[model samples]
Target: MEEKFLKVTQEGHFFDKHKSVLIAVSGGKDSMNLLHLLYKYQDILDIRIGVAHVNHQQRRESAEEEVYIKEWSERRSIPFHVSYFEGTFSEEAARTMRYDFFAEVMKQHDYTALVTAHHADDQAETIFMRLIRGSRLAHLSGMRVVQPFASGELIRPLLPFPKSELMNVPHFEDESNYSSLYFRNRIRNDYLPLLVNENPQFTSALLHVGKESELLHQALRDLICHIDVTNLQDFQAQTVAVRYFLLQHYLEEFPELQLTRDQFDQVLNILEKRANYQHHLKGDYYLIKDYQRFAITKIQPKTDRQEEEYVIESEGVFQHGSFIFSLNEPLEQPDQIIYLQVHQPILLRGRKAGDRILLHSIHKKIRRYFIDQKIPQKLRDTAIVIEQEGKIYGIANMVASDLSKSAKNDIIKATLYIKMKE
Candidate 1:
């Protein structure tokens, strides 16, 4: 068992020579065994070791467990760090808090790797549970032997070894493991034992499933390695399976976001819808789909608001929202080039209630005009118009009023330039 632990760490390249590592120990048999093994071979491995523990305060033995681990570390002259949870937390929240504290410790001490004692049984339990709950193909592979965490690596050297092999060392056991209150506890205590009894090789089979799923993920990753997900045209060109996998891969890049199968389908639905849309996800992040493009952005869509007016006194160049106005420049579209005869200090501004434009000696409300043109709500909010003496000249770059197009001398040729948001 000792030789296998060393071999796993060495073959996996879990540590560099003389690297510092922080081991996450819960004083449970599995973690204590891991700590003992690493301590025995620290000289041969050429590494420094530190111990980190978190007291969830869920069990009555929590305080005793914390002290036990601290004393064990002190006896070996190894550094020990600890944290305490203030109140109750769900299983997921507890797990998050535990890792967060581990990351904090690593940052302060410059530890290169965070070691955990998640053995083969734990891996099997995780994969089986995810399979039962229905998860993405990439997520079915269970915990990785080594993965990036915080600013360093999170290493699980005991992943390929079973729990039975790790119980040789004497250590504390949390009584909560036998309780059925937690979903994982129920799975481990009730369902898993029956499955193992029915087929003694069930755990091994689950382990094999994880390995196969990982291979499939690797193959899918290779297929789309060159594809750009943000490019709508490029993304839509792929088959559905390829697209789904790409999105899952994209979501994985963000540590703050947790990807569920439902969220996956929500994103797909928005992408498939014909019209441009902005679907709000958690916080201020949104999945934005514009004509010819789509992106993951934090910038909120331009909503209707009372916008400030900018007077175009003698515009060489003027910026308003996402638009740039270049005054006195020859425009590509003849109608959009407003040939102003009566210059009464033209102003550029967003839409207002009861705003109207003159068209062939008839008044047309700007709101009704936008509706007739089939402008999207976001575009309408940022849409600008040229106004002078309370008379609308034109909707920038879209249409020019007949009055603005009238033949005249001393005309100022003004055009609008749309600037793409960064």
Candidate 2:
């Protein structure tokens, strides 16, 4: 078992022998074995070790596991950090929250890498799951041995070891793992056993296939990078041309690298359509077209949705979705009867065709006058115009009339303030 651990860690280049490591302990057999093995080898490796556990409030037994881990850490005099979350076990969400906690802990401490007990069986199960889900080669490649985590990095030193090898170390069993309701357990206890019975070397074959596929996948991705997708003036229109170029190049250089007809069609659809154009590729892979530079992004996903529109009204202070429109009562002036008064309610709606506006100064059709003024069609609707009983009193961004019916001693002026949403 020790020899196997050394071989895996050395081959995977998971961590430096003397680096400070934090092991994620779930009190399960896998994580327990991981902690024990690291401890057993710590002296020779000259490394510092810590244990981190997440108490997901799923079952009552989960609390017991946390207690066991905490006691074990104390016994070894190893620093321990436990995080608790109140939620059902949604695999994705739980994983995210757990990693976030792990990152925070790492930031507070000085850990070089966060190690976990994801072994060969876990990788095999993942590969099969992704395969059944019709995943691309990248997903089928399964979890990487070394990858970046929250603040530090994540290292899976046991990936090359089979579950049977870890049985030598003391461990605890979670009853939930036996339930076929969990997809991974079903693959481990049921499907994999049947495959092994049929062909004793099936697991080895799968591992081999995973490795070969990873290499081929990397090569294909490299070829994809060689094609210059930048400067495609119209992404939608040029999608077919870009795809055809890729197909031609692939056929000439790597005929074995053909995607399924459906997959090819889907790729083209993703490239051409605006809706899902921003969708990410597998495992730090992305397709990006930023003006003149088209590239693949390796970072985690970030969302930027379009901002929705808000409406504004007069007389009353209006709070739109993200914008605040405050309309103040006109300043009082004895002679200025044309100024906006607080008495009337203002209507706010989008513009429609043939909507006429009476310019107080000229009494002309506002739309034609706006067109003559060279106002763009897009901005015309947004340009606010105030009216009283179908008579245009003032046009915002254009003109404000001195609507005092009598020679004024004091005049009233309506003030409108637009504030953006927070």
Question: Which predicted model would earn the best TM-score?
Answer: 1
lDDT of each: 0.78, 0.64
Q: In model 1, what are the clashing residue pairs, if there are any? A: none
- As a TM-score, model 2 comes out at 0.57
Where does candidate 2 clash, by residue pair? 322-421, 331-412, 331-413, 333-410, 333-411, 334-410, 335-408, 336-404, 337-404, 338-403
lDDT of each residue in 150-267, candidate 2, tens digit only: 6678888888888888765556678888888877888889998999999998888888878887786677657666343332333334456556555333333322344555755655
The all-Cα superposition gives candidate 2 an RMSD in Å to the true structure of: 17.0
Q: Residue 55 CA error for candidate 1 (Å)?
A: 2.4
